[model samples]
Target: MKPIVAIVGRPNVGKSTLFNRLLGHRRAMVDDSPGVTRDRNYADISRFDKPFILIDTGGFEPVTEDRLLQQMREQSTMAMEEADVILFMMDARSGLTPADIEVAKMLRRVKKPVFYLVNKVDGDKLEHESAEFYTLGVDRFYTISAEHNRGVLDMVDDLMDTLPDVAEPSDREELTKIAVVGRPNVGKSSLVNRLLGYERVVANPTAGTTRDSVDTLFMCNKKPYLLIDTAGIRRKGKTVEKLEKYSVVDALRSIERADVVLVVLNAEDGVTEQDERIAGYVHEAGKACVFVINKWDALDKDNATFGLYVEKVRMEFKYLAYAPILFVSAKTGQRIGKIIASVDEVMEQYTRRVSTSEVNRIFTEATESHHAPLAHGRRVKFYFATQVGTRPPSFVIFTNQPESVHFSYERYLVNRFREAFGFNGTPLHLMFRGRDKKTLARQAHNPA
Candidate 1:
């Protein structure tokens, strides 16, 4: 497991900017607006092969009657629990406030390492002004600018040096990667926090609260899984910011790397064009998927409501026909437990392999039931079929006339195989190759 390093501070102190700076790119959204970052975003970071998990938390307000600030405080508390070292970022321009003093007192109670980071110190005068933060009772402090990448590397190096040696490798092979993807404000963070059984991430009523792909490692039923919470994927026209465009790219990359993807949908709004586009990307990537219809409790439904909604989903996302759908309310914990089980089931199909003899037998029955389409007045004939790969189960079918196989016939063959063997929740890659007499003879002899 990677050691978690959390960045925590009052709002507008440049925590998100510092997070993006540490990642060596603009991942988190940076704005002058306070409380722009309401959720605790996480990402993997490293310097010179020493890797660790980095988390960017919301502003720390220990005591507040305001509902939003209370929720933000809960998010920060959870981050403190998950962190191995906490970086307490302060604004040198604004000096220290009562909120900063309260945060320092809170950190002092916990028997953990906390580093005082005075941010926005762009020059000597600002660095000199940063001395006011020493009154918070932390002996060590670093003056830096997150936007300009000043003194950030040295702080990380020193933080890593202070951590106890972890013998495990940074990359663990026996782990399943699950990515939660959807449009903005579709309860992706809320779903993640519900599954985690804590306020691990800040969830607000605002849209686009999460701007980066945050990864968390956890276990369910003795099986380890990595959950990647990504930013909302918007259409090209709507992605105006340079940061937003990078976030879209990052979300797509997360889908590519995920073993199983939970395509979250807002049940209140039903399926939209943007949702379909996001699902199309998942299908094209050949990733196993689970259609998560969130906010189910808000829907006024009868017995026919589920069927109608499912029909709409199927009609829109026809390419993801094999994917399973589950209705869950992250707010009420309705059917949320089924998510991990569905992921496990899909992983079974994704990594499953079939014998060559079994594959050929199934193909033969399929062709007998539904004949292959003819092309150029010649009948299409399949000689044999074999599975070439596993993890999205790719198969190669050798035929006398590969070009004669029409799209409908190919679909028939895939459907037949899916019915004969359960390929639920995973995509099947079917390829056709034409074989001449010589090649067929060689293949018969080698049986590869």
Candidate 2:
């Protein structure tokens, strides 16, 4: 459960710049593209031993004057409601304007902590010029330069220190979260209602009906389960595209927090490029997944239709070969009941752990079948292996030449480990650690 920190301000106030700067500054990290912050605003930021979500409510330029202030106020208010901590940034070069005063009035109503920041205050001269913004009557404000990295970290340190660190709820461990995601108008919400046996979420025929990811706590056979229903994700060229209005924060956040993801595909559309991108996201996150082909009843299918569809899905999502596929129709109540059982089975595999001796035995047998290839004109030697973690069952293999381990060999070992141990419906991570001292393991994408 990470706290969300949002940067809200008028257009051209360095919100997005600061958002991207904070992403790489101060040891914070995220798996996706951090530098491309044109409209992709939400990212999970892990910095200073504290993990939080950063959202930038920027990009409201080019609008008519009559709508700019109204839109800015709406965006700021919405961000304030969603964010646990708010960073209200202003441009010192442009000085304070009427729009800033209107936003500040709205911030005064918020009970949460709001930090004021004046950007573009590069040197001592600009710092003094920033004094004009004090008329907004803020308790305190810091002047800094987001581009050059001045006073940004000091503000974040104070914000993090002010936020109280609390333990996650004990009951959270009892719920197995499943996030349902797909492109527009894929029957995700309707399918979720069918699973819950009620209309917990509003279901409409139009595309983009659900704006936020809604959660519901349910029980089946005395076991608790949580379902995260999200809106359709936008596929922008080769990357996932999003704007401030159509933010997919909850969709990505649900995937991050869930134990399993339900990648819904429309039966009519088959496997579109957007569906492939959605599956890729789930795979990259290392979560167990199930492909649910919705609207099966609407399709005119014969005896061989299911086989053809399965073959097509296998060809498209070859990376998720370990995942199981289900052809269900929310309209006709077809095969939807099997979803929970499949999730239960996949959950077992996702959290599966293997003993160290068994791990070594598998490695020994795998190496006997196929040997490591020569790299850089040197022979690589494998000494030992051990299981270090689970949730994808990560292992560390000590070897003489970790950097020399071929990528093909890493993939081979992963397949062999999966074949020997029945770790279906989950990815495997095998890190190569060098036997010599002072050589840290540099493996990031080997066999994932």
Choose the strongest candidate by TM-score.
Answer: 1
Which residue segments of model 2 deviate by more than 4 Å? Answer: 1-173, 237-246, 437-448
Across residues 250-358, which tens digit of lDDT does each residue of candidate 1 receive? Answer: 7998899899999999999999999999999999999999999999999999999999999999999999988999999999999999999999999999989988878
The digit string of per-residue lDDT tens for model 2 on 1-448 reads 5687888877667776787687874211122222212221456677555777777663333234644344444545556787899888888988988868877887899998899999988999999989888899888998989888999889888987976685656675467889999987899989988999975555767677565565566799778888888767866652244431343655777788789899999999889998998899899998899999999999998999999999999999988988999999999899999999999988888888887778878898888778899888877878678778877788999888888888889989988888888877788888997765333232221222
Clashes of 1: 0
In model 1, residue pairs whose N, Cα or C atoms come closer than 3 Å (at least 3 residues apart or on different chains), thus clashing, are: none
Q: Model 2, residue 63: displacement in angstroms?
A: 32
Please, what is the whole-model Cα lDDT of each candidate in the order they appear? 0.87, 0.77
lDDT of 2: 0.77
Number of the top candidate by lDDT?
1
Give Cα distance to truth, residue 8, candidate 1, Å: 1.3
Error of 1 at 433 (Å): 4.2
Model 1 spans > 4 angstroms off: 24-26, 31-33, 46-50, 61-66, 92-99, 121-132, 135-137, 146-149, 169-173, 183-186, 232-250, 298-303, 364-371, 377-384, 398-404, 433-448
